[model samples]
Target: MSLAPILNPAQSGRAGVPCSVVGASCLLAAASLLAPAIAADTVRDRDKAAIRAAAQAYQEALSRGDGPALAAFWTADGDIVDEQGNTLAGRKSAADATKPAAGTVRPDMRIRETNLRFLTDDVAIEDGTVEVGLPGIAQPVRGRFSATWVRGADGWKLAALREDRLDAPSDAETLQDLDWMVGEWTVVEDREGRPEAAAGDKPAMEITVRWNANRTFLLRDMKIPAAAADEANQAGTLNVTQRIGWDPLSRKIRSWVFSSDGGHGEAAWSRDGDAWVARTAAVLPDGTQTSSLNIYSFDGKDRCIWRSLPTHVGGEHAPAFTMVMTRKPKGKTP
Candidate 1:
């Protein structure tokens, strides 16, 4: 008789299923994985609801002129940075700043979300604009606002907030630095190979240099004298003054070249090893492009020499170019 084989308790379960003690542990682990997935979904839903509710409450508080209510949405140590990058930190300052607008003017402020960026499960950034009607202001003064929010057990609270005035610089102003170029100097240029000039006219033009208030920036105010036939147009020779200084931001020397003929140009100077190099970009009267480059080397005896590249505009290398100056002697000022 073909009788059914007695089922073995451990091995009789299913095909490919392990029957050893390790198998039970594996089965148990597989079942436990569902708990975390369920928990994650629940937490995500709650966080979403909390963020929405908190954002709505904050908006309402601002429109209602509720100082305490508005403050409630922010953390105790929250900070505010204005458009000019000036920061007002802590609840006290933030509260005080808000009070000005929350006063009797009765603002119709709205906080609609223009952008929402989540940094983590607990941190987020909200960007929008605030429009208010101040007394005597014809149009509404609208400024962009950004606030950082943090998650809490109750909901999301603002941790830091900042706003900016789009049309102007910040209240904090940065002073210019140019303290390395205070001295007297003279420029000597030699112009040759030009058919328009008489013999021995190939070289030599003179210029004056000065610096203001012990500044690093040296101003090159140069004058070009005209010859006998050109004396009638002597007033039209070259009158250019460049305010040169070092820019800490760009880590390069910069200059603003202003001409007496109502023209202007910008220049940048940087050092490559022992050589100082400069490139100038200028606009001509007819809106044409003019450029030049110079490489400078200083001798041990306080003399600076510059070699002009092959492209000058109207005076020297090509047209109006090249500069060299000797450090002035002591006790005599230029």
Candidate 2:
């Protein structure tokens, strides 16, 4: 039996093998043909392992000021990012950023690695903190850093690096007109009374407002805190949407605020004897209907505060909630 001849390109026209005798050789040849595929998988695994190992070593070299060692691990087009979100690209750029930081060392400084995610066999993302000491500075510079790596023909290179200052996550707030409610504020005092206590007596929520160029199309966002939130309703959030505009037909101001949750109501605002008064009405979550008369005025210091008195069933007055919001410093809070 000459099954081998079937696979040999140069041995065309060779006599065919006996079927019974060729079975063993046929199996062996099939296995031989599959050897390259299996070997290829092994090679891929080895390459990935090597890349990971190189990345780890490179990181260690940066920490220890092994410039030459670190440089050897990166591809020619590698990039680096500082903790302040500054980026330096290419081998030269990376070298410059690393070289200066590498020269300084302080025993009290702390550097920690946090998260590493592999997007693919050839791409990865790493995030961590870099704390370096300064000569006279009381505290070390601490910020987060991230790197995007790609496996190139020569080796693994950084495709991009983004560094951003690390800060505590801020409560959301409206950024622009129609920006919608997005910041944290609490109801410190309610003079008119509480219809029912907002999830918290403090009644903290976000306020957002949007306006168009004509100023006629104005939208407002109010978030209601969750009932169970004792600490200013950090967990549960409810939204209130309102639209305000001038009606040419009526020649007056018209607006409505609807609790996106269950409270739906309209508020009409106009000048009172000495200030602005707004009348509001909406249904509560428990199927109770109520109406509100709110008076707003600016104090001697020009701080705005609102008094809200709500009436329900047969015009019976009850205290629901009062809201006083201090103007945030121009650029202090996030």
Candidate 3:
């Protein structure tokens, strides 16, 4: 994931900004209640900037693997308590504890400050999220950290710091990203509101997508006129049943498809920004194997476009095509 700054640079320092600290309840009383909040917040902003700058300094020290510099950020008797309940007490102990990481590959550290409030004029409490990008790890290690900063002659220092690891979402829960597919839809002309195909064109395909009883999976049933597709290449009504669910072994969202004819296939789904990409592999009744990459792009709440790239069948290639699907009205008929 891309990294964001601790805070936007434009947010700090309200110096020279115009403000009318006046209200209906007398000017003096209103000023008394409002001016201090603005003043206190300004002070907090300066403190936050100082701490942020100090954090950057420590980041540089970490890159150099300088254990002493890292220890200097804490007070002489500072305490670092980890999620496992282990403690690194005092500046010396902290320095010694980090000796192992010295001269070794260090992970990239990122901080996102959430809330900061001054306990007193010289001390403040901070809460934020921290992510460390470790070597050999595809995803960063994410966690929440709370730290108490004490202001001494040397400026703000970490007095006590604690962090806890966050749990990753389950595969089933991750499937919720495609929730918009659950609905009734029918193929329509890509140019206009409804189907207006030229005479003798392939018939529209009607589809209904819904959730299973427990809502863990989605089931989609669709129909295509024999003119569009038929089993055994014969003229007969063609129907397709598709089941979409999370695959735990592969850790991906996958769909299994079965047509009226003796053919079956499955596709693994992935998202690329606003569009979904499905890598599909199928087998026909005649033992011919096929593969294609299908892209689904939603136009709006009630419209979507499904486009299939070139397909490789046994030894031949099928041209690509695009089709628009519009959600059918709640109570409508063909």
- 162-198: candidate 1 lDDT, tens digit per residue: 6754333222222232222335555454224222332
Residue-level error in angstroms, candidate 2, position 235: 7.7
Predicted candidate 3 versus true structure: per-residue lDDT over 1-334, tens digit per residue: 4222223233322333323322233567878899989998898889989987876786576555455776788887787555333344535433532322223334466876567778898888888887765432345556677778889998988888776555333454467787888788877434322235522344358888889998778899988877666444956777889999888876778899999887887877766546776657666777655555576887649877776543211111233455787777877765
Best-fitting candidate, measured by TM-score? 3
Instruction: Give the Å error, residue 94, model 1.
Output: 59
- What are the models' TM-scores? 0.36, 0.36, 0.44
Better of 2 and 3 by TM-score: 3
Which of the two, 1 or 2, has more lDDT?
Answer: 1
Q: Tens-digit lDDT track for model 2 on 1-334? A: 8657575544433345444446667789999999999997796677657655765665565545444565555566655443212234445433422232222222233546656667877787866675644322334435566767777777776566565434321222112222222233334453334324433455455555557576566777766667623335245667778887654554445567776555676654544323444555555555544454565554434244555543211121234344565444444442
Q: Clash totals for all models, in order? A: 21, 18, 0
- Judged by lDDT relative to the true structure, which candidate is superior, 2 or 3? 3
TM-score of 1: 0.36
lDDT of 3 at 322: 59
